[model samples]
Target: MKQMTTIGWREWASLPDWGIVIRAKADTGAKSSAIDCSSIEELAGDRVRFTLRLSLKSNETLTLETPIAMRKHVRSSTGHGHDRIFVETTLELGGAEKKILVSLTCRKRMNHRMLLGREALAGSFLVDSSVDHWATPRVKKALK
Candidate 1:
């Protein structure tokens, strides 16, 4: 079996393909990982475009377009079912790198830029709610 790393409720993640290092919160309640994005536009050829909010503390944003991996109907914490667009991206977390499906949504009020859900954590990480920031992002620094 592959050794799994234990992470805290909060940590950092590097999306090397997007050239962004953002803050992430580990949430067992979520079924899939998510990123804060806005102005989502579904395009032809199964592609979707959106703007990623680089960090909670920074006003920086990046507009990107990528092929849609899948479309999923997800229930928010508020219990509203919404269709979420997912795109495959390289996620570097806790010294492990893998392709993970990340959902895009407008998380303007969320505390973290990214929310790491069960699907992203299942085999790679074990989360400890009592601790925070147990693992740092693979990148040197995050956008502030």
Candidate 2:
């Protein structure tokens, strides 16, 4: 078995077939991972749909609409949390990739839209708080 490795602040990731580059924050404090999304729309059944966009200061914005495979109750940052739709997908970081379950939430307000929590980082990475953005930074979407 490959021993899990540690990662710093920023890391490289792709949505597998989505062909989108996403930067995630390595946060052990969180239980589950979270991603930035917009145009959230609830579909029939437990599935939810939304657009994943790349937000960077320099590049033009790139957006893609995707749907959640499942939804479940998840604890929020606040002591009191509720059930939220969770999306299951592979998260690629630092040339390492793993299947991760992320909760669907609006992270537009945060500097880093994506956050990799313990559930996703467990046995995969060791976090170093002293350093920032150990992985190469990805340029934002190129405007057409």
Candidate 3:
């Protein structure tokens, strides 16, 4: 088997498209990844604009419009289905970078600002659920 980078249940990753680092929860159970955003607006030409919330405790946010990859019907843990807008962007994590499709959602109640699911973890990472940050450097003040 190929060597895979081990990451903790929570780790810091970068979304260069928005110029900020995100704290992501590595959820192997979730098939698709999601990001916390608000004020979602769909523009002409298949693009979506929204405010990317950096943290639930802070007021930090970035309003951006990125090209839409596709929209998918997602079922929450409560068994309710909702259509989510997916945007393709560059994700930097564990010393590797790739363009990934991330769905925009309201994750204010969730512990982490971003949820890194199995689709984004496949072939790239192995989650060590017992640790908080086993790999990757903690990024600070990406905006400053």
Candidate 4:
């Protein structure tokens, strides 16, 4: 039997390609992870550009562009449905990095900027909701 790494309900992660770090929530209930963004614009040839706010309290931001991995119809908790754009990016979780598909959306109302869904967590982690930020320190050092 192989041992799996356990992660907290919330941890710090980064999209290293864009040099942005965000607090993420591990949500097994969600099938796909999401990132908060503003100014989402669709480009020609199946590409997208958006501005990511590093944190709610920070004025700093990063603009990124990536080819569309796919488009997904996502239903919100309030039963509202939205067509979200999915893009591939490398996410550094704890000390490990992996390429994950993340849907871009407006998450201004959400507590965390990012949500780590089951697909991103599969085979790589075990969630322990009782803990928080177990991977943040390691991720911070790697990002530096």
Q: Is candidate 3 or 4 superior in TM-score?
A: 3
Q: Which residue ranges in model 2 land beyond 4 Å of their true spot?
A: 56-67, 137-144
Best prediction by lDDT:
1
Clash counts per candidate, in order, are 0, 2, 0, 0
Q: Rank order by lDDT, top first? A: 1, 3, 4, 2
| CA lDDT, candidate 4, residue 90 | 92
Global Cα RMSD, each model: 1.8, 3.4, 2.0, 2.7
Q: What residue runs in model 3 are displaced by over 4 Å at the alpha carbon?
A: 137-144
Displacement of residue 68 (Cα, Å) in model 4 is: 0.6
Model 4 per-residue lDDT at 117: 95
Per-residue lDDT of model 4, residues 1-144, tens digit only: 645667899988877877777788899999899988899999999999998766767666778888999998998767889999999989877677788999999888888888999999888888999988776654543311
Q: Rate the local accuracy (lDDT) of all candidates.
A: 0.87, 0.69, 0.85, 0.83
For residue 122, model 1's alpha carbon misses the true position, in angstroms, by: 0.6
lDDT of 1: 0.87
Using TM-score, rank the candidates from best to worst. Answer: 1, 3, 4, 2
Give the clashing residue pairs of candidate 2, or none. 5-125, 6-126
lDDT of 1 by residue, 24-121 (tens): 88999999988999989999999999999886676889999999999999999899999999999998888988789999998889888899999998
For model 4, which pairs clash?
A: none
Estimated TM-score for each candidate: 0.93, 0.78, 0.92, 0.89
